[model samples]
Target chain A: MTRAFNFSAGPAALPAEVLQQAAEEMLDWHGAGMGVMEMSHRGREFMSILAQAQADLRELLAVPDNYRILFMQGGALAENAIIPMNLLGQRPDERRTADYVVTGAWSVKSQKEARRYCDVNIAASTEADKFTRLPAQAEWRLSKDPAYVHVCTNETIHGVEYFWTPDLAAAGLPDVPLVADVSSHILSRPLDVSRFGVIYGGAQKNIGPSGLTLVIVRDDLLDRSLPVCPTAFHWKTVAENDSMYNTPPTYAIYIAGLVFQWLKRRGGLAAMEAQNKAKAELLYGYLDNSGFYRTAVAKDCRSRMNVPFFLHDETLNDVFLAGARERGLLQLKGHKSVGGMRASIYNAMPLEGVTALVDYLREFERSHG
Target chain B: MTRAFNFSAGPAALPAEVLQQAAEEMLDWHGAGMGVMEMSHRGREFMSILAQAQADLRELLAVPDNYRILFMQGGALAENAIIPMNLLGQRPDERRTADYVVTGAWSVKSQKEARRYCDVNIAASTEADKFTRLPAQAEWRLSKDPAYVHVCTNETIHGVEYFWTPDLAAAGLPDVPLVADVSSHILSRPLDVSRFGVIYGGAQKNIGPSGLTLVIVRDDLLDRSLPVCPTAFHWKTVAENDSMYNTPPTYAIYIAGLVFQWLKRRGGLAAMEAQNKAKAELLYGYLDNSGFYRTAVAKDCRSRMNVPFFLHDETLNDVFLAGARERGLLQLKGHKSVGGMRASIYNAMPLEGVTALVDYLREFERSHG
Candidate 1:
């Protein structure tokens, strides 16, 4: 199974093993005479696949009994609107508000989409600092009894992360729940599911394919949907029906279930967390020491999943990208808004991939300098 | 590439050519060094896939230039609520009203879901007739200046269809637009896109896989969405972004695009319609003469896509199903809501598959009677 290291952000690299298993089962899944794609979602074959996926994910995350796991569609971008529609605006219509802590591009989007559904309060924002760090919890000005506090735990574009969920107890609002968009780094480490009211991530990164959006929410959050919420996006309905209120992206969920199995086979999330940390350290260590490459995020909050680095000589960016592609390291180019190079070493990226990248970084610096 | 014929209602069979092509490109799509699943939706590789899928669909359906084709998620079930959110309640606040014509199980679902978002006017209903046929268009009691009129052009479970789009003028509401859920019978026959304001269906039936939902809407309908509509379900935003408003079911779109190409290779919708008609006639022709089997729907309104038949002696049902399964003619079981057996011969089911089913039906009848 010869394969290249893919580094595209979101719809990024997948475990080679998972892809192989899917290919093998493309025509017939377990002698069911039809592939998972062709099987009815209501049929027993697919129901088994869906049930196993949910159970495996819950076990892996140590999800609390009260949290309902929803396999939704529309990615994290759509969730920017869906999240607010389902969980926010608890009070009478116009009077309800949701507080947002803007860390980077994603959180900024979360707050913007939320504005369509309810009043939005910017509790804190790091845009002034070019999103290199998270806003301190103390500096935040939260609304009294706001619907929920939103945070993007990992900023894919800016390469910043929040190491902890917000502690509103210090702000004298211990009852307020935290909502996080953990799209980029959800399964890269072990997370405390009970700590947050909602934990959502698009499956493209650190999960499985792009169409599937995973939502783990406290049961109570489901019933707070506004009167106007799309019934399909209503968390209570989704959780009650086990995400089968719609078709539920069956193939995407099947792939994600394979990923969960892969994670378990590799000693679960704890092992994956260590491997992710080691891979991140290898790349970050080289960038820190190199005179030709530099990183922008604060040292403490620098994302362990997405390491966005810039070359000192930006003129040679294309040449560097071409070279990386030639060596079978693909999609190393950063986002258009933040141009340079971003090596999104997600869970599927092995330590050897990081080593290959580190070695290339050293060679490129010496030759160009 | 040996494969069995799959007759599932939805998440149904795909073209053999499409599945083979998908398998071949699973690891590296045209040397992009990543599968279509791993490619970014905004990247050139997947963008071409999306653009081609839309263009081919437009050609296949002969869609007008003014229609915006949206590749969305959430299936036809989600469209139940999404349709109301986007089209109903055009008048601001306090929720507007919509008109619904209930012919069968699916139309019942459409109206029930719409009640959550708007006032629903039952223009007409054939449920009193056990969903056996479509009510006469002249009898429909459409609402005055309704936001939009809803219909299930083909009821998958009830095995009934509307060969022609509803004429609002007959209902004395000529200005009202018609919205149709054409999920089961979309590509099985030739259709005129200009007749309806919106034509939507889940991909699994005739398009490709489960996750993708195709929405063909008139450009003018884009801006009528309610303030409560989820932005992702907002037709204007979806049309504006060309369905990239969310990370669409990329792989599903890719597979569907391949199916469209395959359809074109087989001489397009005109050819598909002829084949589907022949397949339906073969099964129906046998049932008509057998006397051992029966079909209850009015012959004029019987769906060419999903044909459900019943055995005269209910006790032979298990034996009939077992015999069909033994011959590899699978998933003939009807919807749970309907007690009889159903055979959904979509575009992917070749005439030879229907011939086998016909031959098996004859043999099973002879052996049992």
Candidate 2:
């Protein structure tokens, strides 16, 4: 049977080709007599895989020479706490204050976890707007001499996106660094790495799987961990050891590496950005035109990766889901916290999958509305 | 195609039955329309998978009601630092000392990493004896009021096993709890859960795969994490959330759950213990009898799973490995840290796989010894 278009907000759909390649290589990776999962993490085979993955990702994002990429574990949730522990000590006088722009649930979580290790300042919040929009940079009440400014560039839950990177330097916070959690929309577009101090995400979305996390931090931000920080999690230690200070989520890393290779073969992040934009546009265009579908987020702020739209008649949710299943579209149910349908069109999602989903949506609207 | 008998130290061989089932379920888990890797961790289908795995594991290990089973990420190496961070607050007023038994490389790593969190006391060490034996309990220089006495009960590299749990109460350390890193030999035999405060292991060796870790912790040890502990790594937070505090390594956990169910179907840990004994006996008996092969660990302390053997003539190491590979016995190469071959026959290794390896060993000896 052909695989369905899985739109889970993640542990979500991987590219069918990538999954097929993985299945084929499950037993032997390139005639090495061992699966990528079975190879030693330090072995030449895995090393080459790791190196290529880093290079490809860096190339795709145009990550600068001043930045170091670390493949870590425990997802972005873990990094929320890890980031503070590593950076809070950059100022020696006290636990430095870190500013957060709370756009949605993910940023809220990052802010809360950061409070355990640093003095967190909520510079701006979309909570009053129910996390449906990004706060304008002018509204942010950032701290003086903050360790870093944090933002969730794309809010997975609220389906909100920051179309452009926030400019801290232009906002008179030139000395402070900006950290972004781009978990859901990380690889869907090209990024200007020099504009941010740190960018991290869980691989469950566009990368590969749940066990791997990707962290890109500027080299200048290295080695400022508080004494209380666990050595395994210390950015300096992890960076120096080349993410091998601990046994990494080796298999997840290998799979993500394969995905990076896949992305490159498909003509890099620029091509992916175009494809993702097209898929999102096709789905949202249908939703916008239909009287039966209503999207919650402001049109300008709507996420290009995760588009959450509700049926005008909420009772039609069951019928909509059933129709979707019959058409081999899956995980279309939105987060229970927000009742609606969400289509996550990550880089892995082809235009055909979105087209199939859009066709089903229109047919369902014709019948139900 | 048949798989070779892989003897990798870790990211090691899995039960063939488990792999077969995993492959069969790779596309859809019990008709759920998603592979374990692709499912949202919070979905009901994956929840049932997670719950059954935890429950089955609890029953198999005879874990008491007071203990919490945490399925975590990052392997045992990360636990080295996480453990101390979580446990050192046990005695609030005193600067708690965590005693360590350094039998080999794993314990030495544990000790070094623990220093990052608390004062470490080397209660006992067999490194002076070249890690060929476990030090006697009487020989330990126990620190009074230690937070815990830590030991790597089975050293994978040294091929040393503690046949008996240390009687710390009788050794004048009654109040101190025991923590064991049972990564290599956790399920090979029955364990007294009442004796250990905490036990953790990376799943790749005897469990399922590389990304998942199994941590069993006693009730009394749950609440004392240092304030500086990363909330995600804190045992209490992880236990309270039932390992769903974050997106888990869903695929690895599902695979591990399958292995647990498979173990239950085969009469649980007791049957596994018996089979492991027979397999170890067959391999060790041949090694003891063959003058060409020699095992350095004391016979009484020999590991039932990992058997490291040296050839009398070291020059034929390459030839021995090449011959073994030719006969479909693969990864017989020894760790670079410890020269000579090591055969890791975990619970996944059947009697036949061991016999095949032994047969290859004999043939290679005849040709090159």
Best by DockQ: 1
Pairs with backbone N, CA or C atoms under 3 Å apart (clashes), candidate 2? none
RMSD (Å) of each candidate, 1 decimal? 1.8, 2.2
Q: Model 2 reaches what TM-score against the true structure?
A: 0.95
- Considering every candidate listed, which one attains the maximal lDDT? 1
Q: Which segments of model 2 are wrong by more than 4 Å?
A: A93-95, B172-175
lDDT of 2 by residue, A76-192 (tens): 998998898888776764747899999898998999998888788999998998877778888999887789999999988889998888998888889788999989999888888
For model 1, how does the per-residue alpha-carbon lDDT over B84-168 read when each residue is reduced to its tens digit?
A: 8788645854438889999988889889988888889999999889999898888888777788899999999999998877887
* TM-scores for every candidate against the unseen true structure: 0.97, 0.95
Interface RMSD for each of the candidates: 2.3, 2.1
| Tens-digit lDDT string for candidate 1 (A1-369) | 247888888788898889888988888889887788998888889999999999999999999999999998888887888887787546777667889999888898889989888889999998999899887888899999788889999999889988877887778878878899999998888999888999898899899888899999998888887766767788988988889987778999999999999999999999998998899888999999988999999988999888899999999999999888888888889988788999999999999988999988888898897
TM-score of 1: 0.97
* Model 1 residue B54 lDDT score: 88
lDDT of 1: 0.87
